[model samples]
Target: MSEEGLEYLFKVMVVGHSNAGKTSIIQRYTKDNFSADYKTTIGVDFFMKKIIWNEDADILLQLWDLGGQDRFTNLSRAYYQQAVGAIVVFDCTSEASLLHSKEWKADIDAKVTWNGKKIPTVLFANKIDLGAGSFMKDREIIEECCRECGFIGWFETSAKDNKGIDGGMMFLISKIMELGGHAAQGEAAPTNDSTITIRPRPKKVEADNKPCC
Candidate 1:
């Protein structure tokens, strides 16, 4: 068992097609709040949260939200560096967004690595609250995608309603902890040396009705 206050820090990145609720997931997990009027993420934003696992270990999760715009994709490689796990989100209402999930997975597989191995990843089907009108209705399709894309697991999430959010995060973190080297009972987890400051992205006057992916 870990000591009373020892903490393990892990960097987890959230990537997906634009406006697929990646930022909202981070916000819901970190702040326990959600807004319907969030703007498109411009570059990258991050927040930190602590979780106690198995009543012993402390996990400091640094959640990184990557901007989903095409222009920002060039910067993804930099953000992906040293990431321990990832959540690839897609809009359930948009087929394009779901298709683009493969692209995002490819991008992650190409860049982020730990000890020359692919980082752990989970696929999130966001916007499930929209209900019954989603483009991809079949679970088999998503399963096939996960199999081909190398995801450890997948979740049907509604960040707007906070459904499946915590469970998905906990599942991913468990996988990360298993794959990542564990610290000794009284040892300290490595610290993140780089300082990160999140800058607000400009909000658009009108929301885009078209699917962003």
Candidate 2:
């Protein structure tokens, strides 16, 4: 229930390379719990959370967790439909995962739009609790990558520790509200868009790589 009788619902997608802790972030955020066990997402999963923004508007965020496995990549674009914002996640300990983050961002950019505008996007460098063994350790490189991918901002987070999760989400939501104001003015993008094309990344030659954070 909102005091001003205004309710806003936003569809937000969480995407990244395989095992970048997309599901874990959502679990920690929506349920405040984390699990050590690993389970690969099949295609896509949905979760919902509500927040009161600026103490007046009620925000319902529909989080779509898209599967990161290469086989499932062909199905990702459909999940991206109608997304007003996105959080592109990557593991802090793996440089490969960080590099793959751009692919995820490109996928999103190719599919999602609000009122003829690109959706707001943020980057999450997850698993910061692992304490800096990442290949791209330099902040300059990370900032350069974010800039190249057109990310509004980036956050270092640990879903297992619940560090920076809430703040990051709030920041993303604020930006979405600010930049995607037209989404609130009318119904969001349709669930199905004929123009969207599912573009999967090229198959990697290596297998048996360790899962990302």
Candidate 3:
């Protein structure tokens, strides 16, 4: 909570089945680099990306990448306590992963809330590059599931190719900013690093993309 600029902090949880590309999405978005052999997150792993949403505010995005294994469910709950937003991902090529997307959302809905209501969640269908053909055929079903599961929106993503990574994250951050604004509500919570500045992000020419913060 710096007085010089409107620095806001938002905690967004990333949850899904193991190997569903949850960690890969975070890696791609935060580091702009992809690794094909990333180990599954143990219990939970964290990353931070600072974006200047607009000239009016700078957002320190605290991303929690939770382990997708059954044993970590209890541990994941502890980290979900104050999260204001969520990103539920699934492998577009895996039918079972798509079905479990709803389960992930439900799990967090019971653990946290934003302003006393359910958190704003977005869905990401990762590995879209590998399944582009089938993805289009099931587009309707995917969109329907997004609505049925209470996601504010959905996007096709490929962490390996760095496609739609920023779009989905930007969309979720936009919604969270709209819903929560910048309340000094939980400023006391310590972060791995403070004094974060909204450094410039790489050039993305897509007109649909949000301005880098």
lDDT of each: 0.79, 0.79, 0.77
Q: What lDDT tens digits, residue by residue, belong to model 2 across residues 51-133?
A: 86754466778899888874245666667776778998999898888989998888888877765566789999999988756
Candidate 3 segments exceeding 4 Å error: 1-3, 70-72, 132-136, 182-213
TM-score against truth, every candidate? 0.81, 0.82, 0.81
lDDT of 1 by residue, 1-213 (tens): 423434577888999999999999899989998999999988889999977665555677999988887424567778886688899999888888889999998988887666556788999998889873444777788899999999999998988899999999999988877765433333344444322211111222344586679
* Candidate ordering by TM-score (highest first): 2, 1, 3
Residue by residue across 22-111, what tens digits does model 3's lDDT show? 988998888888888999888788899989776556778999998888424566667886687899999888878888888988887777
Residue 6 C-alpha lDDT in model 1? 45
lDDT of 1 at 3: 34
Q: lDDT score of model 1?
A: 0.79
* Model 1 regions lying over 4 Å from their true place: 1-5, 70-73, 132-134, 182-213
Report the candidate with higher lDDT, 1 versus 3: 1
Clash tally for model 1: 0
TM-score of candidate 2 on Cα atoms, chains taken together: 0.82
